[model samples]
Target chain A: MKLTIQNLTYSINDTVIVSDVGLNIKKGEFVGLIGPNGCGKSTLLKNIYRVLSPDAGSIYLDETDIRTMKSKELARKMSVMIQENNVEFDMNVLDMVLLGRYAHKKMLGNMTPEDYEIARKALEEVGMAEYEERSFLSLSGGEKQRILIARVLAQQTDFIILDEPTNHLDIQYQFQIMDILKSQDATVFSSVHDLNIAGYYCDRIIVMKKGRIIHCGAPEEVLTSQIIDELYHIRSEIRENKYTGRKQVYYIPNSANISTCAVTENL
Target chain B: MAAAGFAAMIAAMLLGSVGIQPDWVVKILANHLSRHNIFSPEWEANKEAIIWTLRAPRVVMAYVTGAGLSLCGILMQALTKNSLADPYVLGISSGASSGAVAVICYGWFRFAGAYHIMFGATLGAILAIVIAMKVSSVSNKVTATQLVLAGIAVQAMFSAITNAILYSSTTTSDKLRSAMHWMVGSLASASWNTTVYVLIISLVCTVIIRLFHTELDVLMLGDDTASTLGINLRQVKIGVIVLCTALTGSIVSIGGVIGFVGLLVPHITRSIVGSAHKRLIPASVLTGGFFVVICDMLARILAAPEELPIGVITSFFGAPFFLFLIRKSRNSFGGKNG
Candidate 1:
């Protein structure tokens, strides 16, 4: 139920994209990976999710190397929701969700009621039960993201990896999606653009700068104003909420004091 | 549905010119089938040649080719993930056209059988598909859009070459007309000898495709998801393309250049049933068979003594139906045309 990547490295045309990256997500924990644009968070996550193979390194899921596991076995153990999932076909929403059960059922077997129930429950959880008969192409951005989440939920795995799962969402849906991920019992690992959301949800935060981990600790420890300024080259005033006492990051636009660490180079 | 298709075929054969008595048709069929006659000798002796040798073989050929073409269309649509994708989508038809035209102009019958034209056409189709695959396969990915574009380029090239040959040739005008007829597609040349082969190949390919329906469904989700689900997408893509071309090329070799069956049949199937390949593939195959049989029947009866090209019949129906589908589903995926 834990994932460990050690000394992972990948290079394209001999230009290192992710170099010597090491990270871990323990069982039942929510982990967040944060970095400036192009800092290799997506790349590193891609490597772990088997979309990209690392040039040199090992990824262990529990005690076994993930590379040796059959794809079906891995699929049964973990699920991933990627960012760029636009489809050209006009699949019904329910049919789209049913595709998640593809790995679970035999090739020749008919879909059982249990499969429908799982898809229904997943849809219900995402507030999309009423939209099951609607066309997938007709959904708005947030609804589409929720349907994708429902698809992953239908996978019924012990772990889920989300790559910017709320990239195009408004604030309310963004919180709703993050809240859903936070409520899940599965070990959750996410890449996020919003540091505040990361702080609100993640049990631990991994901050990458130039393809390597620059900071790894509690959000409070790693998300300091100085570190934020150092990572993104933007000055930010950090404060605690008046009533809730939760840390918040507010940036001063075009500040000169911040040194933007081009951490994506290491990736 | 199978019974309905059978009924339509019978109706088609019965309604044709000469209005041969059903009893005579039955006796001729029985005499051939049993190799002995128990029926009245007068009707059997007179009708055997017309029913057994001519009309029956041609109609059966029509059924087989129609079914085969439709099956090819369904498979090609799923393989390329584009509804417009068909046997012609990859330029196979144009290549076969060039090959058949070359044979007719050169009078290859001196060295080959009258069926040599078919062999030449199949060879052309195979060659075209191979070249298209090679040209479009950049890196490890073969994009559908790229494949379709490559096919269009090859089709255009082949058509130009065919036209150049036609313009330069000194062959008789009769030969040119025959070549043009074959390009339009026909089951007129179909014989009992060819129907068995077409039937066996088409039926087997249809079964194999249906068996792999689950894999086909997974393929629609894109390569990443398919691979993630333990399906080796590259292997499946190649396997499907080879099967599609073989079935389609053989039919094109024999039947000429029928288009739109592959494009339109799957669309109809999708509307009736959802996009689940389990339902979509089988229904497409059956409906394809039914549609082609009906079209072939139309081709036979519409022109009476002179047979029309089956392709013309399909386009007569397919073009208008395609326009209607496009109009009806303007908000759907097929609306991308505009």
Candidate 2:
């Protein structure tokens, strides 16, 4: 599935949180959204996933206008994994994953054998097959994140949007999550805070600053030192590692304490 | 569990102050059903009246009220995504109480007679829910915390108003006692008509809620996730609130603020069957029916001549059990671990 956002703008109480932004994600591409905190990466993604309505723009999945499409129809084509992990009830893992099939199931129908089969496969894919009967609240943070990924996989959409899905995971779990997402043959649009993970996994990276897309291209072409400095107000160097041959960003701390105003002026 | 509930209902019917023997009770019921006496021809008229007109209707009312209230609790908890939510949490019982008190003490809506109280309570409940929804909504989104806070505020405000009306009324002690008894919760006024009405409402509401079992399950995951999974949050929230308000309002009109059954029954059911609404709703309904029937029986038998209010018994049992549950699984209620 192809996701096309044209001049998407979102404001909160007369303040523009996400200004006019345009991007087109091709089918089966892995795209990363990287920006400083509060630069509207999550807001822009929320608009695309139907969590927020863009004030004066439109998003389209293939040729269908997303605003006009029914929620179930849009959900059939796209699934979202947000950062929220707090659940009000103590639901078990298998039941939670089975909820992913909600859009496809009939109103009063029971979960068929096929639904359970798909859920089991999704759990297996996330290596959480044994935890199906376990309480979701008792799991560690990373385990819960992986289980949520399994739920999105069970949703079986062609496109997936993730808002910092690996926020609370350890290093190994972060790589594991990214590896699972990388292996899936689906169009993925994820907002990643870690530049290294973004560079290592994404086919293309879109950098946003102050609600506007500042750069868009492959990791090596878009992630220049000047753009990084401009985006984050921090001195940084990007270089290819000898062992992994992937771009890595190394931050350079100031020798002396600098005021926030000075740093902004330098940028 | 269903058999146990049925047995409890039979016991409630048989063990009241006028202890009709099981054989006599069965004969009375059979005669009423078949419209002819097949067993004993010399059955006492008073015993037949007690068995047919009094205990049986009250028992059925107890069951329906329990089923309806607990179903409302389950829906409210899921709607607000808060485990502590109950049928009365949204000021609904207070609203109903105020309306009932107004009708009883001030002669409000005097023309409706037997239905005046019911009409007043239902209208008050709807008003309370609308106020809570309006107060909690921020922009176009409603947060769980805000909804709960709004419910608490509305409840306190309505409760104060109810007390004010009771304090200022110039009615005689008899009317005061009746209003007080109703407010404390009683099945003393249960009749065949009220039982049938409650039974129909409970059945229809439970069936409609059961159809949205999957939607309710997704809703427990939180609003954002529910929307992402194709469940419209606003529409589902409104549907749940309206259904629960109707269910809780009708029961309050008949039973008068029967507390804790709605809050505790769903927890017990969830602990047994997990949190999937498909299994949770049916199990909660049966357990709630059984619990209330047993409690109502105890209320009658505990104080021999004068009946104790059903609400007191439920609170006595429900409060201790609720404390135990909270201690056993603090995190289940989303409480932070110490």
Give per-model TM-scores: 0.83, 0.91
Tens-digit lDDT track of model 1 for B200-286:
777888888888877777777666666665565667887787677667656776777776787788787787887777778777777
On DockQ, the leading prediction is: 2
The weakest ten consecutive residues by lDDT in model 1 chain A span: A258-267
Q: Per-residue lDDT for A1-267 in model 1, tens only?
A: 899999999987888989998888899999999998888999898898887899999999888898998767788888888853435456788887877776787756666899999999999999999999988878999998898889888988888988988787999999999988888889998998899888777889999988889999888887787999889977676677676566778766673444334222321
- Tell me the spans in candidate 1 whose CA falls farther than 4 Å from its real position: A13-15, A242-245, A255-267, B1-4, B21-49, B95-127, B133-148, B158-178, B301-304, B316-338
- Give the Å error, residue A81, model 2: 0.3
- State how far residue A259 of model 1 sits from its true place (Å): 17
**Judged by DockQ cut-offs, is candidate 2 incorrect, acceptable, medium or high?**
medium
TM-scores (chain A) of the candidates: 0.93, 0.94
Residues B1-338 of candidate 2 have per-residue lDDT tens digits of 89999989888889966767777777777888799877764667988898889998999899988888899889877876766667666677778777776776677786877777776777777788778768866664445556557878988887777767777774566555655665668998888988787788789999999988998999887778898998878788888887887787778888887877888899889989999998999999999999999999999999987788998998887768756654564553334421
TM-score of chain B of each: 0.82, 0.87
Q: How many residue pairs clash in each candidate?
A: 9, 0
